[model samples]
Target: MCTYLKNMANYKHSHLKNKSFEEIQMLFNNTLKWIESFVPMDTELVKGSEKVAKGCSKRATYKLEQEDAKRQRIEEENESVE
Candidate 1:
């Protein structure tokens, strides 16, 4: 009788473990769908942010180049005076 009960318990545990994989998958899909409903994947937001980042990078590059050019001009003028 004890052996039978142990076998039954083992069977139940195995069945539960099998069901858990499917349950976890269903939970993940449901969660993703719920989140998507609220957030609704915006391509424009990504593109806009990328454009803003590129603009900022270009502006920084231009500022650095201008500063370098100014410094080179000053050094050249000082060299000529010397």
Candidate 2:
């Protein structure tokens, strides 16, 4: 179970790495809302599902932070060349 969640987080981070922060937040919020829509009122299957979702969200944010630093460095180099 732990390994599965870690792989999921890694996949999500790879997929979301290129997205802007706003887009990432929007996707994360939508995912949570979708999960919430399946709450116990209909079925108990969604219990504790937020853990994986939050894990994915954190990974996505980390990926974007890493990419932001690289992007800024490239932009700085370009500006210095001008």
Worst 10 residues of 2 by lDDT: 1-10
Please give, for residues 4-78, the per-residue lDDT of candidate 1 as tens digits. Answer: 323532334443454566664564565557656563346777778888999999999999999999999999999
Q: How many backbone clashes does candidate 2 have?
A: 0
What is the C-alpha local distance difference test score of each model? 0.65, 0.67
**Tens-digit lDDT track of model 2 for 1-82:** 2233224333355666677778666666666576566657335455457668889999999999999999999999999999
By summed lDDT, the worst window of 10 consecutive residues in model 1 runs over 1-10
Superposition error at 81 for model 2 (Å): 1.9
Mark the regions of model 2 whose C-alpha exceeds 4 Å error after superposition. Answer: 1-45
lDDT of 1: 0.65
RMSD of each: 12.5, 21.4
